[model samples]
Target: MITRFEELDWQSTPIGDLTLRRRTEPAVGQEIYEVKLGDEYLMSSLFTVAEEELADLGLAAVAGDGLSVLVGGLGLGYTAVAVLQDARVTSLTVIDRLGAVIGWHERNLLPVSAELVDDARTTLVEDDFFAVMRSAPVEGRGGYSAILLDVDHSPRHQLDPTHADLYDAAGLRALDRHLAAEGIFALWSDDPPDDDFMIELNAVFDDAVAHVVDFENAVTGGMSSNTVYVARSRGTGSASLDSTPAHADKDA
Candidate 1:
């Protein structure tokens, strides 16, 4: 039998000390992967539903073919891998603040690493996602059909203070500028939807909806839920204007 636990890799990033771990989940009788910052968990392979949904729901909302995508966080590579599942997506640019995370994918430290890095369409960038969105348009980096953000714990509860601005009207506008004429933005939040965030989304994008993504939790035993906020500006709206969305500080 294999060892129950193993520490895969550890690296110091700008945000904090990052660690990648693999363990045999005895309860489920399966190997599991995880990413951590110091003692805090950033991502776990056991729970990937919302992260995958962030790509699925966001891409589904987009209206056109030949989609070019931009993903703000490269967690365990679930979101990026899910984005590639769509045949319409021609290109995918995934940016993470920590180069260490990107390195894991290239090194195949994570299960989805090979699929994510081997794909011809995927490009991984080591940079602050918030900073990239701010200068995305100005840098002449071209536009994207969809922008998926899963970096922060939530709009209200950012891992770092610098990420707070991206949830506001001004920051979202900057993000919108990087999108093609008809584009959408999807965000993953560990917390339930919020009304105040709906106010912010309505102010920027034409149509937005909050989805309560329900998933089972091995650690918690009971069912847990996440929020996926999808907003699109496609001339008119497909989602009703009355829906509300919100966020917090728990790392999903």
Candidate 2:
């Protein structure tokens, strides 16, 4: 259909460029934003199989009832939007470092993500996720059912400089505090972390599980996929999501 990027309120940044594209299909009836580095298309809010899985895993953690979710990034708002779909989510607080991202949703992206905004369960926070986590210790932001963080590429491969610290011990511990007794912390990575990362996560949480998802972009025809790391408050596997399927290890 030869879409023009200019009409879509293109946002330019040093890391990459974002185009807020209108949903060309009537059935979809939503806007989708795409991130591109130079000419290389990175990702979009459309067809987010892995993001949805994060929500599913989170809902399963707290038995899917009266849930409060904290999402760390607003990339296309896919994860936040999916979490809003579940009626169990009583409140969802989303944090994004970039004000431009939040603006896109409130300005051009709302038609596609309107349901999430109208749900009365969503709160958008434009601030550093790290600062937000640090404040959690005394801010009484505790008791989240799920804390889903889809930041940068992943801890192993960071698309931004600030992302590296997220995988460190301090970051994980901060995440731990905001979670309820049985809450689940779900993290999405562009690639698998080294063995040491897994060991570190296991040490922080009572029980931790990793799911490697094989994603082939139907639109761009890319072969790369990613993994999602899930951990619970207690070491006894309190998160209700099924442990990594036996086959996932081989895939990892």
Candidate 3:
């Protein structure tokens, strides 16, 4: 069989150049979708276990129906799609800094795009997530039931150096304002758990914890892990789910 690789689209954004591509994996005989910023790989369809887990673990912490959510990144739409899988979710707003990434989904270039586009509960917004968090309340909803983020590689390892501030105490506080009382804030980190980030998260939110998600790395044929940090807004309600395992780190 011939290995097929194609560049689906590319664009120049305020931060950097973005590219979307699709290729066939020889080992799995599966078509994989990927997004890149300059020379860095942003996301890939081949490894989405952590992305999906971000949504699942985030929503599991929240308790209620008619939930509203804000997804910080729209890579392959895995996280957003996972959020929609829960019947309690009523609205989903996915924000991506790169317009080209959004266009790929709109054009049906991604495997999960059609499902994401057709869902009445889903809305795609093109904007810097950190900027939006610092600026205004999203959609004037006052706050959402959950905020799931998967934009940067990690708090310590950001795709853009400017994003470094977002991992700080002030930045976490700003993000907290966008959440409803006791609302959930979950982030995906490519690196293992960081204790210092957890301390900062705890200072901002009422309770914060991290979960380590392990998956098989297709390329290396080895186990790799990602961190999912979930925190609750300062409020009176109690968390419905138990804390994640002890091995998990908080944020980055």
How well does each candidate superpose onto the true structure, as a TM-score?
Answer: 0.90, 0.78, 0.90
Q: What tens-digit string does per-residue lDDT give for candidate 3 at 46-72?
A: 999999999999999999899999999
- Candidate 3's displacement at residue 73, Å, is 0.8
- What's each prediction's clash count? 3, 1, 1
Query: Which residue pairs clash in candidate 1?
Result: 193-246, 194-245, 194-246
Scored by lDDT, the top model is 1
Q: Give lDDT tens digits, candidate 1, residues 46-115.
A: 9999999999999999987999999999989999999999999999999887888888889998989999
Give each model's whole-structure lDDT: 0.85, 0.69, 0.84
Show where candidate 2 strays beyond 4 Å.
1-7, 12-32, 37-42, 108-111, 136-138, 220-224, 235-252
In candidate 2, residue 231 scores what lDDT? 81
lDDT of 2 by residue, 41-91 (tens): 556656587877777775665665788899988767778888888888889
